[model samples]
Target: MDENSHPLVKAALIHAQFESIHPFSDGNGRLGRILIVLYFVQSKLISQPIFFVSEELERERLRYYDLLNGVRGDQPDWSSWVLFFLTACHRMADKISTKLDAADKLAMDGLRRCQTESEKKVWVYTFSDPHTTVKKVSTQLKIAPSTARSALNALATKGLLYSDKQTKRNKKYVNYDLLGVLT
Candidate 1:
């Protein structure tokens, strides 16, 4: 059945069928999980496309595979899949809440240590997109390269971000603590 006819039913059916088909030579599992996100978003089950529970699926990787396989094989148990999906949503929501709390603490800490408005802006942006680079920041804020670099360096020195000393000239910076909070 097409997805539009019965969205949730189709999502469950198609998700299982897609797993059996294994359309892609690689990334089929990842793609199946992504389909769940797309289905939720497209069906208006969620207003924002922020509910990602791929980590949860990966954690229960074996059970996820088995469930999908079972559904496709005539031992269909839609309730099991729905319950798992609901549980994943609950778990991901809890994780996001905790991350928001950590982000609040980080923002408050940054506000205290930041010497300039530009530095504060950079700090907040970095907290939001931890793996972003100076070039991207400069472009985002319409600031000079030097200004972006200085702000980034200051945040790194303050231990809010860590700079990787790879051989590349445009070194990468990451908010390790923010990543920790998410994971």
Candidate 2:
């Protein structure tokens, strides 16, 4: 494809071709799905394969299938498939942007309640993996287990995390706020 061709249109063609070929019996669907992101990446449309349209496509599975088939019909009309693909891309990009904005706001709010450097580190880490154990945090932050536990406990007290049980034997902390932002 040339640079003059719209990237979304190129992505649509690539996805349709991959699906029609059905080169791999087991993973044809998976490969065609991955091709959407690959096309964007290779075209420099996005820095990384972060815009995910699979969720949108899966939600409209019947329409998606019909559009793909429409592109392969005797008349060979690609308008429907291209429109669907572009629409999905636009919706998914907006969704991702909204989620990231919410996450940033939540992170900033949580950071304001942190009093210590250790607590701040733990807070930052939670933005990536909202569900974590003290042992994992300790390893990731290279802090003593006791210090990590203290930090986790502090966050819990500040409403950043929750621990159902107060036992020290085997306790897990969940960053409900971050999880909420993500979901």
Best by TM-score: 2
lDDT of 1 by residue, 67-182 (tens): 76666655677678756756766787788888889878978987899998888999888876899788999999899988999898898888888997553678777888878876
Q: Which structure among the candidates has the greatest lDDT?
A: 2
TM-score of model 2 relative to the true fold?
0.85
Indicate the TM-score of model 1.
0.69
- CA lDDT, every prediction? 0.79, 0.86
Candidate 2: Cα lDDT at 97: 89
**Candidate 2 per-residue C-alpha lDDT over 20-139 given as tens digits, one digit per residue, 9 for 90 to 100:** 888885988877888888878888988987776888888799999988888785787787788898898889889988999998988888889999999999999987778888999999
Model 2 clash count equals 0
